[model samples]
Target: MKLIGVLLFSACVVIATAVQQKDSELTAYKESFSPLNYLNRYKDAAAVRQYMGLVETGKMLSRDDIFSLFNPCHRQQMIALFETLYGATDFDTFFKTAVWARDRTNPRQFLYAFSVAILHREDCRGIKLPPQYEITPHVFLTTDVVRRAYQAKMTRTPTVIPMKFTGSVNNPEQRVAYFGEDIGLNSHHAHWHMDFPFWWKQDYGAVKDRKGELFFYMHHQAVARFDAERLSNDLPVVQPLEWDSPIVEGFAPGASYENGQEFPMRPDNMQFADLPFLTVQDMKLYEGRIRDAVSSGFVRTADGRLVSLNSTYGINCLGEVVESSTHSVNPVYYGQLHNDGHVLLSKVTDPKQRYGVPPGVMEHFETATRDPAFFRLHKHVDNLFKLHKDLLPPYDLSELEFPGVRVEAVKVLGTCKASTPNQLITYFDESHIDLGNAVDTSTYKEMVDIKAVVSRLNHEPFKYVITVNSKRSANAIVRIYLGPKYNWFGQKVSLDVSRWGFIELDRFPVKHTVITRNSDQSTVTIPEPKSYPEMMSEVQRAMRGEVEFTYDSHYRHCGLPHRLLLPKGKPEGMDFKLYVVITDFDKDVVSSDVTVDELNHISSLGYCGVLDGKIPDGRPMGFPFDRRIPNEEQFFTPNMKVLDLVIKNVRQKPME
Candidate 1:
């Protein structure tokens, strides 16, 4: 009996040691991911000297140069680093390996390196990352707002800073700044890029299926939605930037970098000029070749061969060429038009850098949409995709018709009973965001929970009640879109002009005859992201077997914010059309290799494709509207219906 008791005690001691070790590993991993903990490499003598040397040698990373994904040297280095970290046997090993590299490498680059490894490493699957907004608050918040938050933290007085409109009323374009400068929208854009990085290679894991196509579709949707918002503000649709003309709209982002450097401003009426490395002629040449390919219905391959553009894969191929990804048929011929265009606009104000100004907001996806010019630049990019789409034959009647489906009636009912039918009520809502993790409070005796309140456009919970008669019990895809009823001149927008402006509201699969979908559950939107401490606590609980671990809804952060799903409408109500289409799910479903866990994590498949899986929908992105609409009657089928709706901005007390 005495021997047995000693044995049991020894076994218990071993188990406890193992548990303590596991807990330590988990804590280390969580700490490494803290965005605020990013080491200041500029302050390190060795790091500063190395960076200076690279810049003087003209070898530093530049957005204007060929994208790093295609740069052989850069690609190899990144791939090797990612593979090393990903090959770790366990989470503890992975955490230790990352810490070793993170301490030795450039801090900014290590963040990217670490994130990429986490995404592809199967061991790291289902692990929740803290909301990036808290990691790099400067990217998502104004300079003044962030500085004020820091002051509040130091003074031990937490305050909620209101996000005021960035520009004055003198600039008519500023009217829609609320939409362009939205925190959630910008965060979505930033997270989307991280999820589907342009540098992602086949070696990382599975290739991003139709990535090039997604690039075009995502940006295309953003610009289209912006145009609709502009219409709501009584402003004209965005005008594409002319290569030779001067940009009249000046942008003052008022946002700073983590290192306290402000993003450069571009004064109004700045003229485009030739830089030492790039010229106007180069841009024209690239555009001319692309247009020529679209007009001729074929693209020139690298080996001097012609590939037909009249196939299912045409858009994907075009997207690769336009984005100038490594998959492009001929990089030399196509050039890096899309990437270079961003660089040009970002540096136009300081083309020669004589003023020592850094690149503008256009250089970063997170801050780009804050400027009105971003829409104009993207409008130009959309035009290129339109050129290809216009040349293709319109989607025929047979392609759109759902033989067994007929939409008899559709109505949108808001949560508020007093609201009129087929009308959405929009209002300003204030949200308090904790900024504690955004600053380094390690020096303080007590942790402070700084906060900020931002006012954003939100709509009352609404549901779409559609009455459809199905000949048989079969699954179907319901696609919803919203567009302004009239053009800039108050004239009813013709189908040809309005088709491009339609903003997809939601896309989901349904089987019932009477289909009802709540606005809060939109497939294209994501719930409010949890702060660092909140996510950390949940992760810790799951690790200790205190709660069930799941990544079903929180896995993908690259989604439109649920709050801004509806655009802010005029006070009196803005006329808009709610278009719904029920299509055969059989023709739309794509076979995916993802596991059941990953399969359940898809929330924003409409805008931000599934993580490491097929795009899910087999139809060409943008479906019926992707092609030209010859006539309204011909375009309408038994499965499609258009309902008249109004969006009214309900007045609410402004948060002081």
Candidate 2:
């Protein structure tokens, strides 16, 4: 008996020790390894110095340059592989937490940029890294190095802008990014970080078989390769990533700023369908691996009649953290508005541009940055379709306000097919994309079937309080329409409660509760017209009155004066009409309402405007100052204090 007892005690002790060891390893893995670390090694001391010297010479990273890093395969898919692995497991706080935090961080979040700079410069044809640059290829994709980058980005003080960094550290770029501790999430005093895009961009490397490189495709060769063997052996796997858990100081759940951008529901900017790893198979390569990643959950068919018992990546509406209210997936907002080409610019190359324009606000033009965070969020968004269909039961499409808004698959925005209004990419799939293309919304007449999204739906309409506010009062007969487009003269917007009553409803009873018809309230009566224009004028007065408040209130003005502008130099001027289809990624089309008259009357404002003057021809003018013949003896840069004096006195006050 005593011997048996000793054996039992020994077994228990051994088990406990093993558990402790495993826990420690997991903890260390989460805390130490960060994408920032990977960047420094790729950058190294010498590479950083050279990059900075170039920057001082007015050289900046171009969109093509950063995108080039993802070519070939190995470099592009490295981080992508890790993100997949992070999602494979069930309730792994370390992985999910990191993904959510870093993805929202700005694209150029310095620490995140370190990795981008490394991968971007790796295959540069323009300039070769100096011979003295002593970076080993190992630096390109080392988990350990990534850990170091995170530490640096977190601990640095006094802020880490590149110019200042160049003067202090040998690798100013890396140092500034790695030691960007001062960069907080937002100004909320929240203890979080701010950076997301580049971290998402590192998911894949370029595909090639160079002497010093691996020639593997990301979805299949790299990720699915390990994934397949692990499933066969019945064991867990570890994945490499760019970074994790990027506590963005400003991004917290329920933040008044966070509107429709909830986690896991919609992909970033991707309203239709979460674009998965478009395999080469669709284009003639192998990409099904993405569809067959992990068999963790289940899904139902598109028609909602069939259900697959086993789908990969289980469903969790809420994350592991008890406080979080969701864990579906988010859509990717890839800087391009496929909803009909009206993006901030031709190529929203700036990573900063990915974020929402603060709903009713506008940010600086220079503030625009490409948001890679949207891509990461989109991965999860795609998963939501599967999870909702298979594991978690989603509401009926008919009951959804925008009924099946996400079911449609449109052209995944890749190439800029529109050189002019007439020239647009009509169709995009694996084989033929980037061609001048076009599409009609549907077989139906109205555009309602195109990309419209509502919150919920019900079989019958319900009571709703209608509030109409307009800036102009002409005894307006608020003519709402049954169709999605504006009624008759584009003068009013009418929503049908009979078809979309649940949309206005805030919440319904738990479980499945049927809404009955109260006989007395059978028909909700909307009688005479109200003076909506007066109400709207109150709000507009406040906006335009305080120049600082709602300066450029055009795009949001659905009531009146929010017109689409035509591209300049078009032979037939200002005829901007967009043909929209939920499934058609190509949005440029024709419409009668967006006539030349309306186009000519569109509001004009700059992405970044100065209080001094209004934007000219769709572009914002800088603090208006005359071209200066600076005294060679004088000192200061274009944005220096001395320039302010030159502009104030030398240049007249600009007017609207």
Superposed Cα deviation of residue 439, candidate 1 (Å): 3.1
Residue by residue across 1-656, what tens digits does model 2's lDDT show?
Answer: 33333332222222212220122222432555443333333313333334334334534332112211222232223233233223222223323233322322222222123222222322211111111001111111122222332233344311211111112233222221211111110110010001112123222332211100000001011122122222212222212211123311111111111112211111123211111322112311111212232233322222443334332112221110000111112212111111111121112222243552221101111111112222222223323222233332322222112211221211111123222212211110111111000111123222121111111101111121222222222111111111112222323322221111000101111111112222112111111111222223333444445422222222211110000011111122211111111111011112323332333233211111111122112200111110121232231121111100000001111121
> Candidate 1: where is the Cα deviation over 4 Å?
1-80, 86-90, 539-549, 591-601, 653-656
lDDT for predicted candidate 1 compared with the true structure: 0.73
Give lDDT per model, in order.
0.73, 0.20
Per-residue alpha-carbon lDDT of candidate 1 for residues 1-656, written as tens digits (9 for 90 to 100): 33333322222222212220222222444444421133232123333344334435655444222222333455554444455555555555555546544444333344555666666666555444555566557667888888888898889886888767677898898888988888888888877777777656565456588887888888899998888778878998899987888887998888877656778888898877776688878988998899899889899999999999887668888888887777788879988778777778888887886886766778777678898888888898889999898888888888999998999999998877586789888898887776765565546647676777888878888899999999998778889998889989999968877988888898887868898889887888888887665655655565566766554424676888888888777889999999999998777777544332343347788788877867767888888788888887788998999999999888773222
Top candidate when judged by TM-score against the true structure:
1
> Which residue pairs clash in candidate 1?
none
TM-score, every prediction:
0.86, 0.19
lDDT of 2: 0.20
